[model samples]
Target chain A: MITFDDVVKVYPGGSTAVDHLSLELPTGKTTVFVGPSGCGKTTSLRMINRMINPTSGRILIDGQDVAGQDDALLRRKIGYVIQHAGLFPHRTVLDNVATVPMLLGKSRKEARTAALGLLERVGLSAEFASRYPAQLSGGQQQRVGVARALAADPPVMLMDEPFSAVDPVVREGLHREFLRLQKDLGKTIAMVTHDIDEAIKLGDVVVILRQGGKLAQIGTPQELLDHPADEFVAEFVGRDRGLRSLSFDTAAGLPVRPLTADLLLDEAGRPVSWGDGEPTGGTFTVEDSLRLVTDLAITSPVGIAVRVDANGKADGLVPHHDLVDHLAERRAAK
Target chain B: MNLSYLFDAAHWSLTADGSIPQLILSHVWYVVLALIIGTIIALPVGLYIGHTGRGSFLAINAGNAGRSLPTLGLLMLMVTLLGLGLTPVLIALTVLVIPPILTSAYAGMRTLDHRVVDAARGMGMRPWQVLFKVELPMALPVMMSGFRSAALQVVATATVAAAVGLNGLGRLLIDGLAVNDYSRVLAGAIVVAVLAVVLDLILALAQRWIVSPGLR
Candidate 1:
């Protein structure tokens, strides 16, 4: 766990980058710092690794005060991923991933051996091991960056807009892969991003800061969406928050109606078409969010959502009215 | 015009004082001496200034001053001060070789992406490790260009040393002009030009071998 107590960062010119801010980030969970430009989200993240020091407060990681520790030694034990990967252009992909371990005094052979496995774990093939960062695409380079950060297997990871440079499609793919990776590893993570949607998607606890580094809100994604602190936060979360609030609720145990003749399926029981024309709806699995289920139901011509099993076989459907009833029932139960 | 002198048996003779082989050896000796000493002095200063960014005014202005100073005048001044010998010639020639090397080293370090350096520091590399392992390797191509420029300047200018009574290819040009042996003068010019090209080519190959292929 990391704790910040009345942390204040004043630049040399007397600009208060971060005001007197105090917060606690839980261990083995992802915490995100998010805000608009000059909100000091990036500044606050840098303080954790001592890249930027708080002017008059204590930052403790686990139980020890980070201010008194050796900077290089402290940084080595904290995994850091930044924008554009900031990869060493001259090193091969494998060597870039091996940097931290080698610096920590691991033997060359052992570092390289571990690096190869890390590359694979990050979804890179053995062929990419010999290639340099320049030879890879932006998305591929970002993956290598994540691999390099994870190479040391540090308990606390710091990320500063790691996916901001990629295209939207690539960013979405990285987002999905990040969540999956987090589920398997469960390292304590602190990330900074300006995109509120990203904050909602990835953060276990989202820290929204106003300009000058004052905390505006701190809560789970659903809580932030359902109960914003004020007009500023409500406006910042955007208009789709009503739909976003449903993202936390799973589609499982929701009522599934029997399929009628209006729906069509192929021989393998996969969705083929609906009614007479093209299938307007997409498929959602039991494990998907209610937001996706609601979208699939609303977009279909027959007002029903197709439920697919792990094998892509259509098992049942949830009509639009049934979803509304389920939502109403959930609100009453809450 | 100098073909006959180059082919003449007397010039190639092992015992002749003004022989082509002897002249070439002396020329190469002066060039090598100047380069070694200049590199020793300039490389560390350049890299230190580049890495720290503290002495940028010195780095930016030194190359121009080095270029503008008259080599012949400096050699004459040193000869006047210390008398005519190889020492005066070498001191003058080494002065000519310092500017390009120092400037290029400074430029190389200054131009590298600061983000990359920040990343290296954040990854826990000590300051010296960042300099030698990261900055130096990345800056090699630029530093090498500077070194080559210095070498070429030294090779071409070492000819001036013969005017102060030093033995080198410059001896041919100085003595031949005095005696109207234009063939010997032409031969000296040809040999010096060829030497400059050959030396530069050797450095180019060395750079290719030393620079990281990933940078290319």
Candidate 2:
């Protein structure tokens, strides 16, 4: 866990980059710092690794004060990833990932072996190991950056807009991979990004800051979307937050009807068509989010969403009206 | 123009003091000595200024000042003060070598992607480690170009040593001119030009070997 205890950062010229801010980033989870420009999200992230020293108060990592630690030592324990990967242009992808391990006193062979595994863990093939950073695409480079940060197996990772450099399609793919990796590693992570949707997608906890580095709200993605603390937060999370919040709830609890004869099934029990027409909309599963189910139901020509089982066999259906009723019940409970 | 002097086996005798082989050795000795002294004096200062961003004014102005000071004039002044031998010639050649090296080193550091440096520091590299491991390697291409130019200048300029009673390839030119033997002067000119090209080619090969293939 990382704790910010009334931390403040006043630049030499008297600009308050971070006002008196206090927060706890829970261990083994991702906390995202998000804000408009000059809100100090990046500054706050840097403070955890002592990249930017706080003018007053203390930042503690796992109960130890970072201010008292040596800059290099503290940084070594905290992995850092930034936009553009900031890779060493001269080093091959494998050696770049092996940097921290070698710094930590691992032999070259040991570090390289560890790095090769890490590259695979980050979804890169072995062929990429010998290649220079310049040879890879922006998305590939970012993956290598993540691999390098994880090479030393540090408990804490700090990311500064790590995905912002890639295109949206690539960013989506990276986001999924990042979440999968985080699930397995369970490292304490603090990431800074200006994009709220990205924060909502990746963060287990979201911290929103106003223009003057003041805290606007701090909560889970659903909490911020469903119950914004103020008008500013409500506007910041956007008008479609209610619809967005449904992503947190799964379609499992919604009432489903028995698949009737009108809905044709394949030999494997997968939904094939509705009456004489093909299933116009895609199918969802019980594990899928309510938002996806809702979308499928609304888009289906027959006004029903087919819910598939684990084996991709159609077993249930949720009519559009039933989804509306379920949504109403959820809102009333909230 | 003077093929006879170069082709003459008698003039090529290694044992003879003023023969082509001996003159070439003396010329090479002067160039090597000047380069060693210049690099020792300039490389560290250049790296320091480039790394810290301090003394930038000194770095920027030193190049122009060093260039403007005529090598012949400086050598003559040094000879007047110190009264000759190899010292005055070395002093002038070393001065000629400093500016390019210092300026290019500074420019190399300044032009580096700041983000790479930030990443290095963030990864827990000590200041010295960052300099030697990251900054120095990246800056090599620029620094080598500077060193090559310095070498070329020194090789060409070391000929002036012959004007000060020193033994070098320049002896052929000065001695040839005195006796009106155009063949020896032409032989000296051809040898110096060839030596400069050969030295540059060697340095270029060294640069290719040392610099990372990734950069290319």
Fraction of native Cα contacts reproduced by each candidate: 0.68, 0.66
- The DockQ values of the predictions, listed in order, are 0.75, 0.77
List ranges where model 2 is wrong by over 4 Å. none
Q: Across residues A99-122, which tens digit of lDDT does each residue of candidate 2 receive?
A: 999999999999999999999999
Model 1 per-residue lDDT tens digits across residues A61-156: 998999999999999999999999989888999999999999999998999999999999989999999998889999999999999999999999
Task: For residue A133, give model 1's deviation from the true position in Å.
Answer: 2.0
Clashes of 2: 0
- Candidate 2 lDDT (Cα, 0 to 1): 0.93
Name the docking class for model 1.
medium
What lDDT tens digits, residue by residue, belong to model 2 across residues B150-214?
Answer: 99998888899999999888898999999999999999999999999999999999999999876
Query: After aligning candidate 2 to the native by TM-score, how far in Å is the CA of A288 from where it should be?
Result: 0.3
lDDT of 1 by residue, B108-196 (tens): 99888887788888888888888887888888888999999999999999999899988888998898899999988888888899999
Q: What pairs collide in candidate 2?
A: none
